[model samples]
Structure formats: C-alpha cells, structure tokens
Target: MTGFRVLFRAACSRVEGTGHLRRCLTLARELVARGASVGVVTEDNPLARSLAFSSANLSVHFVAPGCLFADLIDDVAVVVIDMPKTDEQLSLHPDWIGQLRQADRAGVSVVSLGHVSASADCFRAVIDLYPSRTVHAVNYLEGPEYLILRPEFAASDIADGAFSDQCEANRVLVSMGGSDPQDLTGTAIKALIDTGVTMSVDLVIGSGYCGDLQAWQTQATAAGLELTVHRDLGANDMARLMRQSTLALVAFGTTAYELMALGRVAAAFTHYSWQEASAQRFESLGAIRYLGCAESVLSCRRIAEQVRQLLADRDAMAAMAKKGQALVDGRGACRVADLLQTYAQETRDRQLDLLYVVAHPGDELMGAGATLIRQIDEGLRVGLVVLGEGSASRWNEPGPSQDRELAQRGLKTALQQVADQLGLSAWYYYRFEDNRFDGHDRLDLVKVVESVIRRHCPHTVYTHHPADLNIDHRLCFEAVITATRPQPECPVTTVYSIETPSSTDWGSVLGHGVFQPNWFESVAATLERKLALLELYQSELRDDPHPRSLAAVADQARYWGRRIGVPCAEAFVLQRHLAATISEQKHSERQGES
Candidate 1:
C-alpha cells in the first residue's frame, strides 16, 4: 500500500521498433518487483498486446496510434515516456506535449527514457541510456550506466570465452533488433557467409521482423554455416543463447546494451542516423565495434573483416568483454527504477521549512534542541537528517559485534520517538559509519546531502559547526554547505551551524577551532521539553559535570541565555545567508510601505 503506481507512455510498431516497449517493460518489471504497481500505455499494436499478455501482473492499456491516453493517467504517481524529441516525431503525437505538461502540473512526476521532444520543464528527469562522452545537464541522467536492460541479462562473473581456432564451429549470434526495416539480419548472415569461416549462427529475429526468415536460413545453409533461427524468444532463453555464443552481431539498440551486460563482445550496425551516432559512441568506448550502416554494399565486407579480425584475437576478444561488462553492469533497470521511485516520493512529500543535517541521531537535539522545539511551536515544518549511525565509534574492537544490529534498531526506535516528541515532519538516516567520515570521499557525502536537499527543498538548514572536535561533525558541516550552494534551483536561503555539547566545547580548547556565536534564539518556554528529550538519548547522555549531561546542558543554555538577556537560549553561528535579490528586496519594501 505504501508503493505508488507508475505509468509508461511509449510506442512499439514496425516503424518505431520494439526497443522502447522492451526497455520500458524491463524497467516496469524491476519497479514491480520492488513493490510498485506498473502500467503501460501504448498504441494498440500486436507487439504491445502480446507482451502484455505474456508478462504476468503487467497492465497494458491500448490507445490510438499517435494518441496519448490522458484519461488513463488518473491516480498515477509517475509517467515514464520514451519518445524522440524531434519535430517529426512530436508531430505524430500532437497531444503528448500538452498531456505531459498537464500531468506535471498535477504533481505527477514525468520521466523521459531517451530523447523526448516535450518541453524540458515537464520532465522530472531525462534518463538517456545511450553512451555519451560529454557531460549532460543536471536533470539528464545519461550514459550506459543508466541503460535499461532485462534483469536476466545481468552476469555476475564474466569468464572469457575461449576463441577456439581448432573448433569446427565458432558461434556467432546475429540479431537485427525488432522489425529490422533494412533486413540487417539477412545482411549479417550474408556477411558471415562472406567471412568464409565455418561457424554456428544463431539468428534471433524479433516479433516485428517483416523480413523473409526462410531466405536467411537457405542462404546460411547453402554457405555451409550452421543456422538456428530463433523467433521472439523469451528473455531468459535469449540470455542463455547469448551466453553460449562467442560474439554477437546486433543492430544499434537495446540488444547492444544487453550483449554488453552479458559480457559478450559485439559488432553493431545502425539503421538510422541517430543510431549511427550512438553506435559511434559505443565504438569509442571499445565495448563494441561499429560497422556502419548495413544498407551499403561495402558494409557487408566491412562487417566480414571486423568479424574475422575479432574472432582471430583471443586477447582482444577478452578485453572487449571486460570493457563491455564494465560499461554495462546489468543493474540499469534497477537504477532507472530508483530514479522513478525517488522522483515519485519527492513529488509526493511536502516541502520542509527547516532541515537539520547532523552527524548522529541525537546531534540535532544536542545542538539545537530548544531552538527546534520553538520553531515547531511556531508552526514551522522541521526535518532532520543523520549522516552516520553513531554506533561504530562506540565499539572498542576493530570490528562490530553481534549486538550491532540490535543497537541500530534501538537507535532507530529512539529517532522515531524523538520525531514523534518534536513534531518533526520528516526524519532521514544514512548508514555512513560513525567516526569514519574522514575515510570517505568528501564528494560522496556531499552528493548524498545534495540529494536530500534537492528532495526536501528546505528554506533554512542547520548543521554541526565545522570546528567541532568530532570529525563527523566537521564533515557534516562541509557537506551541508556544499549541498546548499547558492544555485538558482536550490531553495535554501539561510544556513546556521549549531554547537554540540562536548565536541564544540572541547574543540574550543585547541584555540584554532574556537566556537563563535552570532545568533541566539530564546528557548525559555521549551527549556523543560529540551531536557526531557535528552532522556530519550540516555546512552549519549553523561553524568554530572560532562558537557553532554542534563545538568551541564541546562547550565550551557542558561549561560548563553544570560548573554542574550533570556532565561534560556540556543546559540548558533550564521554560516551562510543568501540575501534577497534587488528585485525581491524592492518588492518586499513596496509591500511593507503599503
């Protein structure tokens, strides 16, 4: 019941090819496996119908060609579209752009699978599966790492296929994709025959293949090559055949990525100009050899020469397998599913007023407990993110004990209890090891924080002061600052760094890491609640004179409160404040004058 519904609006036809539908199905299956309700909306084509019938629990709705079923999209959390962003292609579905915009306006996330002609603002993300050397915009998730392939194609260990020179039959897999308009399967078979090498050929044809399969078989047999023509095989069977084969000759499409995922060397031929461009990118990566368009008379000879060259070198073949597998790890469907699910959840969640980034579960309360309670009392939606588990640092041994899991569960329970007590709108926890913040790449921490910031879009952020004695606190501060940079897309306008009890006081003893307070919030009313909340973190609390103890916490609050002429107060360092723009300030001034 917690899972949301995802709808795919795609096309699959003789002219459009089945790649869109196939990849969408792969992603849909992954999402469903992870507890999402998935549906596909496409033209009432035979391919779509057959796939829908074959895939158990998959819902496939049909619509007119070049039509988007806007009515079918009700109650859907996400809509994934796979269409080219070309003028001619956009003309095919006139209402697609408008429908997509309307869906986006309705708070439904729209994700583009490849290239889509819809306006950029309509899409929550553009996941480009094609290979690219250059960096894309932030919203576009490009390259082979995001390439969606069937789960069956995933391989754990890639063993190099022995290129047997003495073997009578060298296995060559030829697939021209669904509906090979240029008869590339036939072209590949003819090229294999021309290679003059005795081989066992597996001709995998698709449901959309309009070419004469009998002619391909006859030609292969006449040329003294073993031919096995497989028609519309299931993904598992196809993956099995691909694993058994030594090399694959495929058209530039989803199959190419699948072959790469299987760690099988491939040589690709393109049927379209865009496909040729994509093929060149693969060629550059050395994962697959590009043999150009199959329509040219010289293309067959080029394919024959490349096959001969690749089949002869065992080392080269092994290297290609490594590069291909490295490029495509077969978890693309999972990654795409993650993108869809994240966008869906982010769209569904309400924005937060303040987001506190801390190094541990209790760090938020330890630093700004009274201030946070005051904000919640004032009707502000507050959230918290703990970057580390704060468990590993407590262990005296080098490794963790069996009690670690139990301890983590207890910590989670305590976090939920704190959330319930503080009336927080949200609370997030990451499993970064406690006390090992310095061991991790700083950008990794930054990226995680950035993802959260982008999701919640909080206006104000509070994090640990950078000069704290704890390394995790310092790293958390750096990550929050970097993640909340003054970008036009970011919603954060102010950031404050709070002082932890022991870490900040101890860090100040080093002289260089002195704590300086520039802002103070009177917490006179919530002082008792802050002390009560400290009871939830009993493990983190200390006795009597320790800075983290209840008595010391109250003493520090009274100390800061006296400086600011209040009964109790929380102090903070104003780390960053993005002042209003001239236009914004003028607008505010005009309203104030009224």
Candidate 2:
C-alpha cells in the first residue's frame, strides 16, 4: 500500500508551550515509519520550529499567527489538529472550527487530538488519551492504552527498582514541559534545594525557555547543590536522564506521561487550570503527588515537603512507581498509527487510480518510472510494489556469510529513497529471491500479488512485459495476470505492461515475443524525476552498451518520444482494460444466469 500524506496543525509558543508540538512530532514519527508522508503545519513559533527541526525526515510548514486553517490545509489527505490547553479552554483561534468544517466538506479526513470544547461532529476521529468521560462516538479512541509517548520512552525499561533504596536514590529530575513559560524550573530548583537532603538535581529547560540560566546556575552553586542543566534534549537522552533520577518534578502534560512510562515517581504540578484534571487523576490513583498549580504561594513549600517525605519512605516511593508504570505502558503512538493507516486505506479506496508492481527494487524506476511520476504529478494516487529482494546481483561476490544481509540492507535503503522521491502513497516489498523466481512456488507469488491488489484496490495496474529477458520480470507479469483475473471482488480495471530499458529491448535476437507498445504516456515533465530516482539505485546501473546505463535510459526515452511525436514518453502494452459500466453489466448478466 502507498503511504498517506498527512498534515499536522498545532499551536505552540512560549505562552502556549511546546507540549502540542512535541506530541504531534511523536505521532508524525510513528506515521512516517508506517510509510506516511507527514508534514507539520503550525504557528510561526520559535519552539515549534526548533522541535520540528529536531525530528528527522519531517517536513515543517509555519503559518503566520491568526492564519485561516484553509490556507494551511492544501494537498493533504488527512489533517490532525492539536490545540493547546490553558485556563479552562482549548487555545483554538475563532476560525479553527469553521475551517475544520470546510476541510471536512472538502473530503479531507480530520482528527482532533485531546479534548476540545467544540462539538466533535466536525472531526472524522477524536483522540483523547485521558478522556474524562466515555465518548459515545465510534471514532473516539480513549484511555491510557492510546497514550502517545515518545518512541524512546516507549522503548525504555521502566524504573521498577527506582525507589528500592531511598538513601542511595538521591538524584532528582525537574522538567516543566517544553517552554516552562512560567519559569517554574527556578521554583522547582528552589523547592529541591529547600529539601536540605543534599540531593543532586538534573534540570531540563526547553529551547523556548527565556529564563536566566546563569542566575539559576549561580543559585544552585551557592546553595551547595549539584545541579546539571540540560536544554533541548532528545527523547532518548531525556529517557536516559529520567532513568537515572529517583524523583521527577514535572508539569502535568506529555512529560508526566513519560515519567509514568519510566515508572519514575513524580510530584506533578499544573501549569494551567486545564492540566489540573490529569494531575489530580494521577494523584488520586497514587501514581503521582499533585501539588496544585505552580503559581500558588504554598506550592513550593508543599512540593518540597512532599518530595522529602517520599524520598525518606522507600516503600511509599516504590508503591508510587508501581502505580505509575501500571497506568501507562507507552504503546499509544503505534495504536494511533494503526488508526491513521485505516483512515488512509479508506481514503485511497475512494480516490486512488494506479498501482505499479515491479519485479525488483530498481525495476519500477527502470521500467515505468517516468510514467509513475507523471501520473502522481497529475494528482493520481500511485502505489508501488517490488516483488523480489534484488540481492542476487551480489550473490557471486566473495564475502562473509552475512553477504545476503548486507545486500538486503543496501537494497532496502535504495528502495526507500525511490519511494520518497516518487511521493508514492503506499509501497510494498517482497523478499522473493531476485533472478530466481522459478525457485519459489508460483502459487506463492500469485497470492502476494493478489493480496496487494485487494489491499490497494487500484483501478489501473502496471507490471513488466511477459516477454522480458529477466526471469523475475516474466514471472511477475504472470503473477499479476493470475491475481487480477476478472472477478466481482477485484476492483482492477486495467493492466499495462511496461518495457524495461535493458530487458525488453535485448530480447530481439532471442526469438522471444516482442514488446509491441500501443500506449504512449507523455512524461516530458517528469523525465528528470525518473532519472533522479534511477541514480539512487547506483548499484544497479550498468555501463554503456548494456542498455541499462543512464545515457541509454535517456536515449530510450528520446526514441520512444520521437516515435510518439512527444518531447519524452514511456511506452506500454495495454494487455487488458475494462470500463466500469461494462464490468458491472458482465456481473449482472452472470448473476441473472445463476
């Protein structure tokens, strides 16, 4: 299946804080891993920009403050909105709900993260990891099972023995979300110092924090406290620091969930009234000690006393850790990914038009790359499939027993680049042996192609010509034909066989069936993209006279273009094509006869 293109819109800034941005990035990472192209559209806030840059393989777009949602909702299949919570209301601009309605009417799938005061009817799905009440909607995914923790936190080992020996567990961690706009780090540091327990402190401040760092360092030094200040820490580094600390003083947001994921007992404080629900919920469950709002006058002294008492009582600290771990297991991002994929599949079934299945990793680019690019540029959802591992090219090389592993790894990297360059909505790779398709049972290959057809439900299918010189290409064509045979359940309406630059043209003297192309697709605009993708598979390129050289590829495109009276073109043989009306008529006739 091809990946979906998603747009994530959130509010983030020094005042709004970075929780919304951070959580959105977490979800984006998971979606990207599942082969979705994720773009984050948010306010032009420094914190949001910094956090977006920190995430690899993500596209970030910044909008001016008060920009209409319609301005940022272009060319996306799905849109995720993450509104900041402050006071008692979600930080949604006046036009957000109206824009969401517009997006819904535009056929774009809309999802809302966390609770919002507006009616949920505008969204396709509503996700609140900690829903205060049962949402009676079928699209609502609530409870701790859907908690979206950073990947590092989800993978980290929980601190099951963090408080086993309170005397030795003297390290305290203090993090008040990303911005800490209220400058609560200083207060938390002061409360930690007032404990008078001679504990070391690890303080995390986000890049959005505009506090006086030097003054805080001076105060900690003068107070005879060992304090290490960290800024802009990555997810893994933060998880590592949390594991080394005995207690965490954090705000009631994503950070609190992270602490719970690591089973670190924390004294949670609310930076906003909207955060009080989560804080008090955790406290009531004995997972954390809620210390009211950080702005309260008695909060500093009360938090200090609570931390001191918890450190002194090993049993109490351990109990808290146990309860915290039980509350969150940290697999929410994957669950959310699954839901997004379902939505994407549904969208594609309604909107997609083409699927290209090739025999090997580079075959898609080598055979019909230009055509695929042109189709996608024309607003068609193009899916890709590579049936073989493409590892046989190195099978004869002299190397360690792990040569196969190395080849597979190299091919996987190249194919991923190809997928990204083509902007495919979905991609699938099978591990059938390269150049040795005959070695496997033919039924297996048929089943693989059939499954892909059923999943993607593409209207048009492209594969290699059956007469191609490559054995794998021949087998792939056969499999596609068998799998896509006319059936009431199969949505495939057409199948086109493309010519590989090397294989199709080289079989002329072998007396094999010729590739007689009757269909020519103009690819003048996307010929460069095809060439660029071919370059990514450098290992597969052959020298001059081999017909697979870069120069030969361009020459072939020119020859085909000249034949069709175009600047550049790709040739294809239309093996089968059925109009929807005719297919429905055939089905009706068969049912009547039965």
Candidate 2: residue 345 lDDT (0-100)? 62
* Candidate 1 global lDDT: 0.78
lDDT of 2 by residue, 502-548 (tens): 78887666576899999998888888878888988988899987788
Candidate 1 lDDT, 440-549, residue by residue in tens: 78976787677656656798999998778988999999999998999899899999999899998888655546789999998889988999998998778999899999
- State the displacement of the C-alpha of residue 87, model 1, in Å, after optimal TM-score superposition: 7.0
What is the Cα-based TM-score of model 1?
A: 0.63
TM-score of each: 0.63, 0.57
lDDT of each model, Cα atoms only? 0.78, 0.76
For model 2, what is the C-alpha lDDT against the true structure?
Answer: 0.76
